[model samples]
Target: MNAIEKLQSERQRVVARLAEIDRILGQYEELQRIAESYLASGASHTADSGTVTDSVKTQAEAQREPSVTEPNLPRVKSPKTPMVEFERVVIELLSEAEVPLDRSALYKALLDREIVIGSPDESSDLNTLSARMSRMKDKVVNVSGHGYWPKDRAFLPGGYVPTGVDDMPSQDATSESGLV
Candidate 1:
């Protein structure tokens, strides 16, 4: 067989492996969510009796105090922390890099940093990252020939303007105007 045929065959195998890995990762994430939910709900039972006890109820009752409450007042829950802060991480990485990094390179960098990515409902995927970068036109600029670079380095001494930054006015103007 020709070299092109061999390469195509190899590509097919690699794609299959990637799909399998993705499936396994999905299962792993499901199991992780289940375990976390169980732990968060404080699952406990007697060894011999195998009966569940209400630990939260016991604790709340012990700490309960009498307080005047208005009949019309509504109860509010505290805000939840973010599940993943990937946008900040990417912005920091892109800003710190000396050269522009493509999507694959950025993904590898994130993985090396122990940031779990590519799972469903996660922003670390390339599509999501690209959408975010596109929205953050001021912070990142896409070079014509090169990849994405920090906006500060958009000028290349060739009198060429980056794509999206052209429409966005000066950051100073935006801040002063407070329209951004």
Candidate 2:
């Protein structure tokens, strides 16, 4: 095809794609409205039934026009706890913990304090937290499978010492012996 014709064709395709996107956005908005109405209509009633009614299902299906289906599209969710706040809460939890806190315990603590505002999936949330902790090497220390400890050793519970730490000589001993 000639350059002019090809350019026109591309333009037409872009316009068509934009229109499709607009339609999909509208459908999502309608779905959100329906969900909001359902919530406002006392979702407890639905929960008591323990099964979705056919009418509600059909109504939703009818509202959605058949189109290109991309089942893996990412969902836009509520904002997560800010990085600074997350780090602060984690430090607080670790410092208060008597011993190293395992991932499950830390996750539970975070949830209890409402600091974990990330994914609803437990594994994903754990992974995210693990990654964050890994990056906080200067602020926290991981005791292998035992869990996390505050980098500030003083924050550790009284008489609690991480494994392998006892094997190392103290700075005082090394300095006194002129090992520095």
The C-alpha TM-scores of every prediction are 0.37, 0.44
Q: Rate the local accuracy (lDDT) of all candidates.
A: 0.50, 0.60
Q: What local lDDT score does residue 11 receive in model 1, on the 0 to 100 scale?
A: 68
Residue-level lDDT of model 1, residues 135-176, one tens digit each, is 767667776666776665433422234456754443322132
How does candidate 1 score on lDDT? 0.50
Count of clashes in candidate 1: 0
Angstrom error at residue 58, model 2: 24
Candidate 1: give the clashing pairs. none
Which 10-residue span in candidate 1 carries the lowest summed lDDT?
A: 73-82
> Which has the greatest lDDT?
2
Candidate 2, superposed: residue stretches over 4 Å from native? 1-77, 154-180
